[model samples]
Target: MPGTYPVPPGGGRGAGPATVPGDLLAELDRLLAPSVRSLRHSCAVDLTFGGSLAPGSRDAITIRHLDGHLGHTLRDLHVRAGYGLGGKVFSMGRPLVVRDYFNTAHIVHAYDRAVAPERIETVFAVPIRAGETVVGLLYLAQRDDVAIGDRIVARAVEHTRRIERDLAVGVEVRRRTAAYDEAATRDHRAVADARRDLDEAISLVGDPQARRRLREVSQRLHRITAGDDSAPQPAADGVLSARELDVLQLVATGAANGDIAAELGLRPNTVKAYLRSIARKLGATNRTHAVSLARESGLLP
Candidate 1:
């Protein structure tokens, strides 16, 4: 509680206190070759999220690659625990190799469908890690009897390391940015509270002359709070009575009192009475000046 900072609504340590670093997911995807991208098109490599992972969840996953013009991405992932090739590598936190998945008696027989549809004769699954945690797994496979060499798996692991480093940097940037925004909001609120306290103290003075001076100061403060500027101005448009509007319109058009009375079917004295009321409401001088002031203040055309 000693160093607590007030955060604005929906703002915390993640809001870019500094400029956002580059997106790591896009960078990692770019490092992948076209062949890898095509193969991974079916894989569930979710790079669109940033946050802590759930207690028992890994960050990403891999699925088998299909051949021919199936022309569809992979869906319906079948996951197991240390069972099939992908599951074994995920649980052991080590790379797995199966030359012929159907013949692999050492690993569980689950995920047979994944291997069968892809015609996988040889496959490799390597777990991607952040520090000691296995964040995800990557799979490489060929449909025919060509052996998937160890070199390709090594290269994939190197890429994973690069992605992990970039991801850590981005996470740190987000955390620091959130902290700075929280501090700024705290400082602003403290300033606002201090101003409120000062206003309350100014209202509490008791001596007659002092009270009178304080009341004047309070009225000034109230004007500031209410956004009122003390200038000799017309009332806001539409604030005048119907008679006041008729008088103001005649004045705006430069009509004489006799002409206005004739136009409005009123006595000249009645017109004069409405004119005085309009002038008083608009804080204006006499007839000629009232018209000028009304036009200037936007109450009359």
Candidate 2:
């Protein structure tokens, strides 16, 4: 049975101002409001979001948002692990409900001070997970002691799952943005180093012809490094399929037909057929000539 646990003064309530971006929080409110409304119409009257803002802390889930009449009482409430109905759901990583909150032996009554004011008798709590980690808790409550049916529980789970997906996508977008910024910094440094090396080489070279050739190569490298540079367009006469391009890229690396077949999960005969078609498209007589044509056409780096 769940039992009441002590909450530190001014601790078991919503933390200070939100750390999440305002836009993200607004978007979350927009996306989640409909689900809460739907749940209210179909199952329960009150719905609250206890977001896991501080994963490292014992009292991680804070009641951040509410969507019903009981909002005034439940707002800013914090639920720690293994305490209260929401905490039990968070700690257990599952959904739970009680027909009568005060009488139920499955959950602690530590939250009665807040819940009693709201007159919430029946309540359901579901854990919202981003991948394997529980990131939030969703609660559905009502003023009566009516039992929450299985369909309502399933609906609550489904709604929470959608929130989990959005949270995961936000996390992935942040990770990719950071990675791209790091890569751009590295590229800038590499371009600077290459320019310095070219200047040094030009100074050391005595031959006029060699210096001119180096200058030409440097100009080409600069063009390649420009952000506006686009991939070479294929010939107007023929367009290669994606699979053919895959095979051609492998051929550009000097891979044999058998090696290409193994890498592409195709038979050697299929590899030969692709090569023949590529040769025809490029007007090349053999595989070696076909590779040369592809390089000249800027089809492969």
Candidate 3:
């Protein structure tokens, strides 16, 4: 919430994409692989691994990622909150270390079977957090019984900070994307409602000139709420049939063929036929183009 995401590959986080790709869990994993690779190469840590909290729960940490494991002993490891080193880190919201995991008295050995097969002696864990909540764990392990010095801990924390920033940005992106989608839905429904009300008013008007004026006002409303952004060209000569004009109105509102069909009591195939007819009359190449040209020729609002 405090900072902005650097523009990602496809667009900026503020640009409001539909959803954060792969959700929050996958965002954690995205940065984890590179961090693990860097940690294993940058320092003497024989093993580097991490896991995100399973979505919707903070009681368990599932490790699907690791580097330098000789066998599959630690693959997809599950560590509960407050039990193993990772659990202690999760529960305390801080880092934890053990010179000898098998002999450690500082934490319980709930994951002894998982670690015994790894033959790892020194184990270090750091909490990856978003705001005040611990969202994940990062682990550093070695085969020798040795103290994890402050130097390595600081480096590990540096990597953890990167992960923290990534998670925070991911959270913001998800929030923004959801808000954008909701606003779009709200706009869509509003256009439909306004169109319905305006059409009802036009039907009640008995005077021909007043009815025509009302129709022009309706077109103006459609243009404001629903027109495309693309530049327009002069419309072609042929006049669109009434049914084709009806189809164009819904198209301007960004309705799909199925929705347009249901709205006008036409079949899906009939909607498609009307769209083709509209395009031909307007000299347009596509749905958006048809709407733009119709607006250009004062055929649509």
Which structure among the candidates has the greatest TM-score?
3
Please state the error at residue 293 of candidate 1 in Å. Answer: 24
For model 1, how does the per-residue alpha-carbon lDDT over 192-220 read when each residue is reduced to its tens digit? 46546754765464443453344334334
Model 3 Cα shift for residue 262 (angstroms): 36
Model 3 ranges off by over 4 Å: 1-26, 207-301
Residue 83 C-alpha lDDT in model 3? 85
TM-score of each: 0.47, 0.56, 0.65
Error of model 2, residue 64, in angstroms: 1.0
The digit string of per-residue lDDT tens for model 3 on 15-75 reads 1112223467677877788888788777778898888766556567678788898878777
lDDT of 2 at 95: 72
Tens digits of per-residue lDDT for model 2 on 157-184? 7777777678668767767888998998
- Residue 18's C-alpha lDDT in candidate 2? 31
Q: Candidate 1 clashing pairs?
A: 12-178, 13-178, 13-179, 14-178, 17-177
Better of 2 and 3 by TM-score: 3
* RMSD, one per candidate, in order: 15.1, 16.1, 13.0
True-vs-predicted CA distance for residue 289, candidate 1, Å? 27
